[model samples]
Target: MVVQNATENSIKIMKNLKLKIRKTILIVFVSFFSIFSTYAQFDGVFSHYMHNLSLVNPSYAGENNMIQASLFQRTQWIGMPGAPIMSVLSVDTPFKLLERQHGVGVQFLSDIFGVFNNQQVKLLYAYKYKLGKGHFSFATNIGMINVICNADSINISKLTTDDGYHSDNDPAIPIGKQTGVGFDLGFGLNYVSDTYSLGASLTHVNSPIISIGDKNEFNVLPLMQVNGAYRFPLDRDNGKYKINTNVLFLTDFAVWTSHLSSILEINEKYWAGVGYRYQDSFSIQFGLELFDGFRLGYNFDIPSNRLILNTFGSHEVFATYEFSLVRQKSNSTKSIRIL
Candidate 1:
């Protein structure tokens, strides 16, 4: 009789455990959906955007007319549970085809937020031409995104309960993983010259539907961005000392954000800057030309908003490498005595 009573008690505890797990799952999903549904769609944010412009603007691909590659990683809201972490890889090169200058690129990215995950791949193409004393570019991108939710990550065995029965396969709880895939499209335009650059882009123009569950579908909304940068010579020391001012504006129709920053370059090797995001955060930036063709950059963001109370801050680090084709060609020609 004691053995049977113990068995009954165990069953009761198991049932209560299952009940609490179900309730927790419900609350988590409700909170996530409630936060996301009010916005156009969830998009990753970056602090080192200038170094990774191709992530936001397709027209930026091959803008420097060189074979260039960049990698970026960002950790947002450190010390906050379920904060976002993202990474991106992008490469592009200038090419001549059909007697026209063009740019081609490929990009891959992975993002994780709490229990949600997103992976994406994109192909970018840009047409280049001359306008006035500057150059103009128009670009388009095609991509696919896979969205997922992993409910198995939750801890269920730790719960305690006194109920008499337990259903481990509760239908109300998402016990496994759910995923959906969708197509994405983007457009961008850029104009650049010796002194300045300007760009505008629109992403997710199609509003693709990502169906995580049979009954749950999210329509990715369009995001718009406009950016501009100007370079001013501070002193005429072989163009060593100069200040670059940049502004970026982003909007997803419902919410908007802006970044205004400036960098002082020294001897074409070192740079440092500071920035402010309206009602969002303050940022510090630093970069180095590590070698002839390699560069490294870092940005630290401190929350000036309410989020500071719950989290420490955010960090972004990126690196870039460029193939100096112009110098390579010049050397090749000179080596053969053709020049």
Candidate 2:
């Protein structure tokens, strides 16, 4: 009889535990979808796919055959006043020796809006792995984020009402600008098979609290990202004719709400794609590279929801160059040099 009673008690406890877990999950999901459903702080930052390669993941470093250098920029919520603008510069190189290959890389990132801006410098360490005929790598990154933020110059007139901005006369508002320090760590797994590749990464593990006084400690973020690309061969026997499409999906459960983009590249020289975002609006991008050495790109944003359109859709442009190239040898020894 005692054993029977104990069994009943155990079963009741298990049932209660299950109920609590379900409730917690439901509440979390609802909270996640609601908080970022409207205007968001970081929504404008991840509006384009190109920016992800340079700023979000260290695994993106030096995955290709040659040393790679890139620059990307984005202006969110085209036509919206006080929208955010972002820029990044990155360089990565692979080392090949003893039939094994690995790479190292670095990047610089800047994000600005209203009177605030954030700058980050990152270092990447990568380990190479072979897949079929091609090779790829998984990498880890560490960064120093120098947050040069100035809340004093916020230009309250431009911010208007209810977007989480307090009036200049508000007690919480400070009269002077302040600086903060933070750090970030990232891990990514990359793979390239045949003419296609895929990768996933988690970035910004150090989540710092940027607010004054530390009354409520808020960890800035930890993000999850997945990226993929495929290269297509065009025409018969046209060795130089090829097209590539790259897609990047991003989300930070805390802030973004929704951030995703798909970019299509036509041949090695040109690319164009469209993006959808809930925080601010939709974005379109176009880019071109000449002789695989000089690169240039542009993005256009159009406001989505109501009211924000009065400001204007934003425009951004970027330029990049590769100062050097690597040539692969065909294992030929020049006996003809004897002549």
Candidate 3:
């Protein structure tokens, strides 16, 4: 009889503990939703922001003076369910017309998180003019943004009823896959020289709105970004070693984030760096030039926020290639009069 009473008490205690845990989890979820709903969704975060300048700043198109192509992929919050995954592809080239320099490019992006997926395609153009020892560029991009919500993938059976929530009975919740498309626009200004660069941009200038269904809609808000970088020779005699430092800032007026990084380059062929994103994560990067005009890079991020408790980290990889399309003059003759 005593053993039976003890067993009953033990079971009651376990049940009470589980109930408390569920309540705690529910509170955390509610708090997270309340905070998230106040902010607008922005572009996917990239650890290799230096190489992805063209994605955020249209003025970065063709800054390399060669036809360039790049590809990137990132997976965030490893071990965390429904974390973000992103991919990007872009190409740009420079041209001279009417004695003026111009640039043109195209970019494609895909981002997925939770039950939502987003795809984007943009056409970029830039006009450049000499400013001091550098060139100043004004640029713009127009694009289509498509968003998809996979409501059908949600498991209603797994949802707990302890909170008195019912997915099937909720009118506000979507029951099937929903998709929406909207127009996006952006503008940027940049200044670039051999040793340094600076840029600022605004994306989603139109604040586009898209309706997924009669019950759901999405509104994209404007985001502002600024970045700068400087490079100097560490081995001045041979100029084979150098240090590059970069900073990037992003804001949607209500929220802001920043990143600072420095890289050591050897023989212009190898690089390693470390970076910190404010209140977010710390990253390590390494890269090598695989061949002439071709390079590859990788980055690993260690979270510093609450996400660290749930995830191991994030991973990113990228590749870039650059080559000139213009033909070079092989030989030149000088007249004696000119000499």
Per lDDT, the best of the predicted structures is 3
lDDT per residue for candidate 3 within 228-277, as digits (tens), equals 98888998899788888988899877688998999988877799999999
User: lDDT of candidate 3?
Assistant: 0.79
Task: Give lDDT tens digits, candidate 1, residues 1-339.
Answer: 999999999999997777777666656655665454444274776767776577778997877667888899999899987777899999988888888889899999988877778888999999999899888999999999898878667653333133223344444434568788999999999888778888999999998888776666778889899988888779876777878888889888878888888888786678898989889899998989788657898999999999999988999998988775555544221000000
In order, the Cα lDDT scores of the candidates are 0.78, 0.59, 0.79
Kindly provide the TM-score of model 1 when superposed on the true structure, using C-alpha atoms: 0.84
Q: Stretches of candidate 1 above 4 Å error? A: 1-26, 36-42, 155-173, 324-327, 330-339
TM-score of each: 0.84, 0.69, 0.86
What TM-score would you give candidate 3 relative to the actual structure? 0.86
Backbone clashes under 3 angstroms, per model: 1, 8, 0
Give all candidate RMSDs, comma-separated.
6.4, 16.6, 6.0
Report how far off residue 173 is in candidate 3 (Å): 1.2
